[model samples]
Target: MNTYLHSVSLDREKCTGCTTCLRHCPTEAIRVKDGCAVINPDRCIDCGECIRVCPQKAKHVVCSKFSDMEKFKWRIALPAPTLYGQFEELDDIDYCLQGLLDMGFDEVYEVSQAAEIVSEYTRLLLKTEGIKKPVISSACPVIARLIALRFPYLKDNLLPLLPPMEIAAKKAVERALKEHPELKREDIGVCFISPCPAKASYVKNGFGDYKSNVDLVVSISDIYFQLINSMKREITPVPFSRSGVIGISWATSGGEATAIFNDKYLAADGIENVIKMLDQIENGMIPQLEFIELNACTGGCVGGVMTVENPFIAKARLQTLRRYLPVSQNFLDENERYVPTDCFFGEVPHYKPISRLSNNIGESMRMMADIQRLREELPGTDCGSCGAPTCRAFAEDVVKGQASLDACIIKTARSKCEGCKNNNEG
Candidate 1:
């Protein structure tokens, strides 16, 4: 009966109750209980980590289907920049846009074009004074959520700018309204062809006060076969090569950092590496840097689990694709002209602290003390047999009443041996 908007879901029927997802989860959101992986919705960031690791293919991303597009009179496809990397030897970007139209979309808009706009705004924001040191990119929803869950104190470091996808959706809707005045906004559906579940969740439940412009979202892998089949047969191209290399480069790792000119920045990819960098940032280790670009996936969006192609190959393809077109300052300038008058990124609320053990200060302190005492008693080995990632985590779970002290296999075995000795003496 507990309802929460989550992009990543577990298929209980298919789940083997294997601890693969439990061990790999970055947020400790998943727990193996009742012979199935149960996801804690508040803790889940929808990074799709479990989807990639699940051997039984029990983990899946929930997204809008192709059939869902039928409800809208005007269907616009907003393809993520990573979608370009999926096709092999793709000569023109228009070929891909046209292919989306072939997939039954009335129109197509490139998210890379929006990335150019965001990049410009990022540059402008960096120049302004009084902002926090090492401003983090808010492009990755998973990274933003990770900070909210684990590092709430560092929420001010997040760049207060709308991600490229949302900006693109806004622009697409604006154009739709301008071109076709007869149609109602409700009649038009803005669909984002997303590479990850995080984006899909973002569309459904937006960050902060702003509502999402994107009406629906479809996974890249779901439509990969259809797009491939469409691309096999030639169609009229829409001359969609206006977006520059800097914008297109956002699909790969270090691309965002590269786009920002003449600034000391750190570019980190993969969630674990991002977490490490965040820890260093928190400790004031890297004080000289002005910005940090963090991507949840290994090779940025190209490495998203939904994509069919290998991340390295896709990154190489993106690099090659960049060479074909000349770098254009026009796109950068156009970004300034085309953006909405209101600020793209609305006000973001500070993330609520996740470690608040209790409302009363005294009780919370007591809980922490108990957790520490429990941790000292348990073996430090982080063996996953207890269904918790680490001994400390298991101790915390015990204090929270979600787990028992006997759940620790080492403690359970020792207790059993002690009981046997007492029985023999009796």
Candidate 2:
């Protein structure tokens, strides 16, 4: 827990005795005991999958909530492009803006503009950087974190660019304050409706130690039901038309690709598919591809763990909406007219990349030897009853200081049986 690089929280009050979180956890980081879920910090990835699956609504992300918007004199909502897909009847982009105003926000902005900026910057980086052949997008923090943890070899290949949310949040705030010279910076709050927990976590942790332009980040799922219920009572849904077809399209796989490139790019979603793609690319099997877009969740942000509506339904709704919308290029010219002069990133903290390689190679080798020694003492049953994938993986966890020897069920049982036999003989 001491070496944990991110934020993690649990609401014991909201937890039920359900084992939903324990079953789906990739790292076996959770355990149910005394009718409550306990997270093993060393093993937890802070993926927010637990928050995604928790049925009791007890799980909560740590951030400024919607009510916090009340403090700002002028507020803007930076709706992730994924957000447009969450609603079926939203036919106009302005309607979505009006809805945010009705909810108490003073203005609304699109993160997709930031995506446009990132896209341009990405092309430049690709052409000049003396790095890997196919550079990965750092937009999805979950995907970035996963690469940092499981596949450090690909670190050089990842494009070192901030995600659209950060870029959009800063641009919106600075533009708003500049447009109204009388407005105080302290009086404005910029909130992003996040599609995933990693986005929220990125803001909370101060991505690379920079104070995020985004003041609040609410999950798309939480906002979905809450917005619907609020709209029912308000008697008027904000009038909405089409967001750019390409921007709204960001909610699904191949979305960014559709906006920018075609065949030279590769788009894949879901952890399984992404991993397979990374493997093939890493092994020099797919060098022909120039760019890669990966979303840790299937169906892109719409398929994030936090969403409530089915991805299928959302995708259908988005497609229906896209048909009625104009292309993104309509707004592109206006965006170019007003150039961002200040470098907001200059004010933020710079982060050093944390490599996963063991610092003490000899020590790690010895630890691995000890782990193998202990694995020989295990049952080799991959039942996951021991809170790990397999005995060998459990051994690696021990080597990594992520789990204790007792965390292995087979080892624990053997120790317990030996103790019982000795006690009885004595």
Candidate 3:
């Protein structure tokens, strides 16, 4: 029961077996079984790709409700930088921070502040000797999980640093404890105002050996009306925003990469484009760069399905907001040269390469051969009619006995059904 805690859910009643989600799913996690889309627990990285492509709106996030924050004594809000761009004509970031306080949060902490810290630490890591070149940003939880599932070889290239959300949660916890010594660790609740459902899934199923410090991940779309209403009440908001251009810039694609202040880096957004870039990296087809930053969403967090505004509009708003701010507001002390010992987690322990057909090399090779042979028999058109995304994927399903060869509508329609071979030959 604890193995899979996916945030994306499919409403079978709404699903018409259109196969839209099956094709859009980056991990091929969706499969139409019995006229309803079913998500495979192992392959799903909770990137919200299916949610974006589902025509019937059958796919939705199973995020934390606003009332869930009442579980603890202190409720702290950790607003991602993407939240700042949701408003139009927003001259100040404090308006949003104060609104969170009015919405029942005991304290408000900017995830962007932590992002600045991450950027600083990342800069230090880049100069460190023996560290892998082309250090892939681990900021996106979806990218990290995708690497573990499909691109395990690139695991070494992953930057060994806690993302802004995690860092913000950790810092907020420390602040809460310092202010109130009577409160226990579990007594404090950290609610992250997120633009992505993948953040919620990350909280549920932690990456590698380190667990997320965030208690709840509530989407911006879920609490949009309430927050806007709260913002309207405050004419003069208190100054609480500690983030600057470098921090807020993390909202869009190439933002984090630019913060590195390094020229040798590649940045791409959208799951499909990200997958393509990762493939190029795996095959060593790209130029030798120092860092690779990828976002599963088109325009990074702003392009998240849960966002209120269009990604381009949000990005433009963020740019305008950053103009009034400094380059950075958070920085390590002059005495500090290296990131503290606590910044990085232990090595990944859970990644076992779930994409492999079998544990044994011989059996895996045999399965691959069978899958290739089945691919030859089936139509090459990737119509997604067989409940699988592509013909190759359908072939894999048939070889694994999870699907029938007769499931291919084209093959069966053309009198090429392998199941009826004996009858046809006789």
Candidate 4:
């Protein structure tokens, strides 16, 4: 569990160390070092902002290849609702569903269909007694990781339910096994067609105590061309899409919160805005809301770096596609009001977050004192020449023995000038 795998990597050859990613990163995980920008794994939440902002296209996502799907006898593709928004002038989602089959998948499952079930479960959880107020949606993997790293105080606020992708994967595998009695669990492969690197990281590192049922994560951009060709070749799509308007709406901002029929919910997208809102929430500013839906991507999942279409355009396309759909095609049984116990994820272990200075109160106090002292000595300007995101970060690095005080170029120059003045006076 200590080992963490990230989905995005830097192409050193393509990177110019231009500081574009450094300036835009929400977590301040990147720093220009040795003529290239390096990302610290401990600080990164896999928000894909670096990938989205890179000018040289140096940051690339590593998605599961189609060849990986061939390992199992039955391969199921769980397409994210964002996939439907990539095509222009599209009326039916069945085209995308059937295209996945044509592209070598034995089964096609829409994650949006499972979203309705999750939505119902969320409503039930909110109505229950003693639950945390202003509950946070665990739908976005990046948001979950961001909270775990920076806002550990909000851990209890996170919804314990498994995300739609995980739920769909578990259900898809179960259906495959039930339909084929002789098939073993190992014979089935669940591949999620993801829209971002955060989801890919989620599949790589399972959530909490539960290992993911999803075996592979394929990016939407990776197979967009093939799906387009496949849809063109298939005249009739068989009308097998099970998701409705509520499910499709999950691809855009405020979709989940709106579906819960709760006006006391706050839906915010983009990492910078979310951080500000979370800061306000931590200070007990937003007491009226019962739930907080935060998506790290700009326009929900549609704005992910792995998607081919523009977020606004994709959102508009999704709106057009939802015109003829029902409110919700999937729902819990009429008599069932409780969320299934199996749908809830395991308890997440509380590791020290990135903001945590030290586990020992005395040590943390001493570090803070030292950091404040250095903060006064160094220039307040947040220049990246020191290979640290901020002066405070460099101060911490020095305290931790990862950097030296001499690394502060401005301080060093100031000291040299002071020495020259003293010499002249002598």
Clashes counted in candidate 3 amount to 0
Instruction: Report the lDDT tens digits of candidate 1 across residue range 177-231.
Output: 9999998999999999888899998888787777899999998888998998887
The TM-score, computed over Cα atoms with residue i paired to residue i, of candidate 3 is: 0.96
lDDT of 2 by residue, 279-368 (tens): 787688885877789987778888876667688788888888778766763343544543243322332222222322256878767877
Estimate, for each residue in 225-310, the C-alpha lDDT of model 4 and write its tens digit: 98898886338768889999999999999999998898899899999999998898878887688888999999899999989999
Off by over 4 Å in 1: 1-4, 232-236, 329-341, 349-351, 419-426
Error of 3 at 245 (Å): 0.1
- For lDDT, candidate 1 versus 3, the one ahead is 3
- Model 3 RMSD in Å is 2.2
Q: How many pairs collide in each candidate, listed in order?
A: 0, 7, 0, 0
TM-score of each: 0.94, 0.81, 0.96, 0.97
Clashes of 1: 0
Ranking, TM-score, top scorer first: 4, 3, 1, 2
lDDT of each: 0.84, 0.69, 0.90, 0.89
Best by TM-score: 4
Model 2 gets an lDDT of: 0.69
Report the CA-based lDDT of candidate 3 relative to the real structure.
0.90
Q: Which of 2 and 4 is the better model by TM-score?
A: 4
Ranking of models by lDDT: 3, 4, 1, 2
